[model samples]
Target chain A: MVQLTTDNSYGTWRFCAWNGMIFMGVFIVFWGIMGHNVPPYGGDMDASVIANYFRDNANLVRLGMAISMTFAVSYAVWGISIGKVMDYILGRDHILTNLQVWGAGLTVVPILVSSSFWLTGSYRPEALPDEILQLLYDMAWLLIDLAYSVTSVQMIALGVGCLRDKRAQPFFPKWVCWYSIWVGFMFVAEILMPMFKSGAFARQGILNFWIEFMIFFIYAPIITFYQLKAIKRIEAGEPAA
Target chain B: MSDEQSALQQSGRAPGDPGVWFFIIADMAMFAIFFLIFMAGRHEAPELYRASQAHLDSRFGLANTLILLTSGACMAKAVMMARAGDVAITLRYLLLTLGIGLLFGVSKVMEYGTKFAAGIAINTNEFFGYYFAFTGIHFLHWIIGCGVLTVLIRRVRRSGVNAENINWIESGGIYWHMVDLLWVMLFAMIYLLPPGGTA
Candidate 1:
């Protein structure tokens, strides 16, 4: 059994665990709130309307997207931390653990790339044509929504790994494991997003944006809570391997 | 029998892992939301929705419903037989369930073909959009359930039902039932419920 306590990396592990919350907070405030994407502009909104909003709020959008792009790395770092814990539960070379980290790492690409598109649109919204700005905005949403499977894989990998833990007391409870998988599966609804522009399947609509994204937000906090507890247990000299 | 297996036999205990229950409840809640959205859409353009919905062949939906229900019954029997250590009977029922599940998929594909042949599609109108989205999502669930059943069949074939493996069988059954339950609700809302009637 590996002695997790004397490993000298617990402090870093704990800090990385905290990154999950930090990523959620910064991403929500800057990417979601300040960027005016909490519900996002409607997919069916006219180009002029979308361009006008960006042009009108150029500075705020630039600030939000720029900061969002930077902090998005925190999500990957958080994944590494979770993957480390999973490594202890499974082996370091375990397929699921590798998948968990890889998924988390790849998930950053779309978020960062999408944020760049939004940032570029807002970079000089005054100089750009309405259609050009609208194209950038639509591209961003498409990239973000369509690339959701990576994050879903991360969630499922984590959930399945935790469920496989046969310790006397598992790292995460059964409900959280299943809930993580459920939230991951729920992202399938986003596949319909590009098809509908006005109804519930639209990017800004109720089901796609509100319910789908909200559950993810809820899932993050729950997983973080359990992870923090699991870290403490390991530090207290529980055998991780 | 192990304590876990003994507890499984108790009347008050739920079948499968508690985690699966969480999934089942969460899944039902999402479908509930989907149903609500469908109702809200139908309310916005009752005439259009009613007209589009009228084009659907209720017979197709009815046939799929019966097929899924039979599959669900077979899965339940499989779970029971597995618990009773009747590995041969369990495999038979599991195979039956898988066959019925395939029938549901085939029927759905044929129904989609009919719509396409008639110039109706997912993007035809608001009603068709909801129809395709709802049924499509449910179809994915059924496909996954079939996969789960396949695994259980393989497990029983290899080692039969032991204390360690029975929970997996029960959990797989629970998932299959959920697929059936969701379809029944889908059938009623999309097929049986006529426009301007609430019961």
Candidate 2:
């Protein structure tokens, strides 16, 4: 049996771990539903049509994107907590731990910036030209999709760290670790987002939006479940075996 | 018997890590989405799909399929050799598998070059989009599979195969087989299936 280290900040760890769930909930409701991005405007949608959408639903888009942007950092907070736990498992100052934390922190940047772009478009839809509105929308999608590698880095680090835990019982199950890596690898498909306008690889297409985004949404709660459980075990000073 | 064999006895006849099956299953599901979407698109525009698919040269597809199946055979043989504690033969078999797999890559690149020469590209149409994206993603898997084979070869060379190291070889073989299986499916769906024919 491997010895589990006692940590003084277990309470904080619990809080940060729970924040992942909260982030998922808030992001789904605010950013996805209220922001009218449940399916998102299509890449092939006309510029004037997009402009009209913002012009018609300005307040909702504004409020939704604003709130979603604020809660986006909760993901970062949850990541930091996961990083601390990984540091405990992998050892202090491990390169993977650093990569995990850094990746998590950087993951917030694209989310924040993209959401702000949408919010800006809705800030005063009437003042911006139709093409400019479409430009902002396009830019947001590119930033969000292309910047996926940062999150991939975070996921791979965590997955590798947990997989390497040679304890009788790893912090995460082997299936979860492999699934995390799979999800990270799946992000490679997002590279097609820039190339397609109206197919399964498009921003609003089935493969890109439905499969990619849903997998990401599903990954959050799964990791949070394991993170909460691991934190609980550590809090009780239980042996890993 | 080695520890891996003993463990295999205990866990039944499952090869490699059972956990790898999860990755394999997930990958299958992902490709299922791609296939489903392709089918859906075909249904939407049957004539266009028929025309575009007609442009594909089945010879290249057939060659690649044969290449992968041959490599998969080599990989299986290598795993058998490793299990038999024949490290030298295992290394040789791995190298052979690597060479065969590289032929698939070369064949695919030449096919793509022919397409480019004829002014057909991924963005040319909906059919081409599906064509490129599906095969392109599978191409990535092939590349990764090649990398895995290289690692296995190096490991066998450096450390030799034993009970502890056998799992790595088994797992790598399983992954390589999956790459082959996926390409086989891709070839059947993209090359063999008539545009209007449902499989």
Candidate 3:
């Protein structure tokens, strides 16, 4: 049986993990307020139209990216906490655990790189040529949308681990395991975004953008809900056998 | 016999584990979202949707629907037989379910082949996109359901419908029924409904 100690360090990590949803919620508000949400969806305009918006809202864009960066870091922490529980479930180190951590760690890259690009575009939109600004904007969206495979890998790892749990009361319920797998499968649709400029498969399309975002938003909360419960069980001295 | 009855009584509370229901409910909700999105798209382009819908063969959809419904019936019979400790009969029903499921799969492939021959594809239009996306996903579920049926058949054959194995058999049957239910909706929405009407 695997048991976790109810100590200060573990307590703090668990607390951080539980608050992962807050970080994401705040990030969404900031991003929306800064007007970065709409332009990328193609619901509003092309890159040229958005370049002007970025040029005008430079300071807001910079602030949004900085705040989003914090959320990215928080997400990594949450991922680590999930990996820890998964490790306990397996009772030993496993490649899936490593994949979860690695995938979570690499997820930060896209957010960081995308935010940096947006920041650069907004930093001196006046100094940079319009085409250059447009290029930067497109690059940011591509990284954010297409780089979803990293998160998919993380989902796959956690899902597989959960399904493999053989305990009477598994650390994660079987449904959550299937949900994780389904969410990971849904991200495969992101690959179609670059090929379509409009319609459901496009970046701004309902399936790819709206439904995908809704799923992503719902995913964090569900995982955090289950993860917090699992942590509480561990803290209460429940064995992983 | 009492033991078997008790097992059946237990399985009666839920066809599968609570977790399986959770997955099914969530999956249905997601499909509902897809339906809503597809409907909204149709509203935006009624004529285009109608033209695209015309390209789909309703008979193929009807055929697949009948196949799945038959398979689902066999699945139900198999579960009943398993609960009665009739392993041989249950195996027969399971095999019948598997065969009908394969027929459904074959019908789907033929439908897709015809569409491809006509140069229709997922990206050809909004209607085609929804057609392929919705049916394509349901098709994946069918494939999974077939696999589950295969496992259940093997388990019943090996264990002969013991108390321990009954729960799994019931779970797989429930999952197959869900696949069938979803197809009924898909068949009606994608094939039977008028292009401008709601599913």
Give the TM-score of chain A in candidate 3: 0.91
Q: Positional deviation of A183 in candidate 2, in angstroms?
A: 0.4
Which of the numbered candidates is closest to the native, going by highest DockQ?
1
Please give, as one word, the docking class of candidate 1. Answer: high
DockQ values, each candidate: 0.88, 0.81, 0.34
Second chain TM-score, each model: 0.93, 0.93, 0.92
**Residue pairs in steric clash, candidate 1?**
none
The segments of candidate 1 whose C-alpha lies over 4 angstroms from its true place after superposition are A1-7, B1-11
All candidates' TM-scores?
0.96, 0.95, 0.82
Q: What's the ranking of the predictions by lDDT, best on top?
A: 2, 1, 3
Total backbone collisions, model 3: 0
What digit string (tens of lDDT, one per residue) describes model 3 on residues A1-241?
Answer: 5543334366875877775686678667766557467536373356667678777788898898878776777778888888778866875567887888788788888988988888888888888777788788778878888999999999988887887788788888888887887787678667767656687777788778888888888888988888888878777766765
TM-score of chain B of 3: 0.92
What's model 2's overall lDDT? 0.89
Error of 1 at B30 (Å): 0.1
In candidate 1, what are the lDDT values of residues A100-165, reduced to their tens digit?
899889999999999999999999889999999999999999999989899999999999988988
